[model samples]
Target: MNAEPVRPPAEAPTTELERADDGAAEPDATEQETAAPEPAQQELAAREQAAREQAAEPSERETAEPVPPEPSKTAEASPAESVPTQNLPRDPARASDVLVHRALPLIRSGELGLAEATLDRAWELDPRNPQAMAGYAALYVAAKDGDRALKWAKKAVRRRSRRPQYHVLYGDALQLQGDVTGARKAWTRALSLDPGNREAKARLADTSAQAAK
Candidate 1:
């Protein structure tokens, strides 16, 4: 009643051959992996070396040296550090004083433009110069610029009140502005300060004559 399982001798031999073939194919794949191309590896190494060389090379700017600074004239002239002096009146005033004095003759001769040019130079040299300030004030007054004349005259008076010419100039400006009382008071103050000031005396006489009219 029971049937027995049968084994084929030919089939067993065929299964053994197939297992050997699989083993042989695994060894061939291993050989192929070991024999992979070396050219790509060499190229990668060469590129890395080239990058390192480029990083090591000096740039155009780094190789060039810096230019030295030029020597200053003042530094060469003196070894010791010098102190700056305040602008004070020169013991005997320079050509600036002469220029201011010459401007007066131009002003007297009715050459306002020439007088103004000289005074401008004199004031530039000595900014707080009384004579130059007064001369410039007078020039401005002659040019009919009362505001500038008053400004310069005030500066002149502030610089040197002993020079009564500045007060006369201020008085003249006040007179032009129709402030007769203020002009009279300024002229009176100028005369009181410098009793022998010829210009102040002349202006006071003119003011009195004009007021009487």
Candidate 2:
């Protein structure tokens, strides 16, 4: 009987440097793979990083916030602003006082013609009164008579120099007559006399705005 021949396994390929360098053997591909992750593993990591960034883009956009709008500015109001008016005298206790109470309301209500006639009756009763003089000035102001208002307002303040309300009336008359400087002085005087006078404070506030212009 005849027998068959057996062959050994083939050797791996190598170059001069791969075979030996300074008496040390170069590593085979399997040994290199065990020593460190290289080209193939690095390429796979780069592809996964790119995929993760792409997948996160839509969620990042959905979580974004919009800016809100700002509020608009408005004009500031005056500290002592109020209706143009005078405090009515205490309930009448005299003949002339009865007319003052009646006529002051008429003047406030804009009935200048009737108020003037009623004021004439009060004038005949007590012509020297500062209250009557201021009332007359206010009535003339309502009547749109700047000259008359100024005239009577001046007389009223002169008649009662210590009265803050009379000074306030004088300021109103000065403003109506286009004497802004005089009006400021009158209001300033009123404040010096009675710092808590609200109408004087209101008039001065308006005067300050006018001066700025």
Candidate 3:
């Protein structure tokens, strides 16, 4: 015959202590959980995430990256660059001479208004310029204003007493004003200043011949 394993004999539990032990042992709910409590676990995870972000992120106001300084929009200019080189201040006398030279051609062309305007600007630059005075004299002579011409010619002679050209201009103005004696005296003075003055010689010869007649 085959032998069978012996087992313990069954007995019924009837006492309170025996009954409690005999009932199926209930598993502790707290021991059954694999993780911590829900609230504590969530709080721990939030703290870990915040710590990771803080370590990885840079400060908002500061950085290790190099940034170049921007150029200023209102930087000061150098003295030479700040001021214009063109149209610098010119000498009044030289500017006056340029204007007077421009006027003489217009006078010869009988553009009296334009000549007078230009000479006026020259005079404004240099009031005592003898060339400017002589230019005015020529302009009035061309315009047939004998008295004005005489006035400006006299001013020219007063300004430059030794220039024979100015003396010739004076004599011409005197002749225009019908002052024959004054004109002859001016021509004689011009001849004394310049022995080679053909205009003075011719004028004297013409007047002497007229007087003899």
For lDDT, the strongest prediction is 3
Q: For each candidate, what TM-score against the reference?
A: 0.52, 0.54, 0.55
Cα error of candidate 3 at position 126, Å: 0.6
What would you estimate as the lDDT of candidate 3?
Answer: 0.84
Model 2 Cα RMSD, Å? 18.7
Q: What is the lDDT of candidate 2?
A: 0.78
In model 1, residue pairs whose N, Cα or C atoms come closer than 3 Å (at least 3 residues apart or on different chains), thus clashing, are none
Q: TM-score: which is higher, 2 or 3?
A: 3
Query: How would you encode candidate 3's per-residue C-alpha lDDT over 176-198 as one tens digit per residue?
Result: 99988999999999999999999
TM-score of 1: 0.52
Q: Write the per-residue lDDT of candidate 2 for residues 12-91, one digit (tens) a residue.
A: 66778865674696679898777877899989999999999989778755777966766645354322232122443443
lDDT pick, better of 1 and 3: 3
Candidates' C-alpha lDDT: 0.76, 0.78, 0.84
Question: In model 2, where is the ten-residue run with the lowest total lDDT?
Answer: 77-86
- By TM-score, the candidates rank as 3, 2, 1
lDDT tens digits by residue: candidate 1, 164-192: 77898988877766777888788888999
Q: For residue 62, give model 1's deviation from the true position in Å.
A: 60
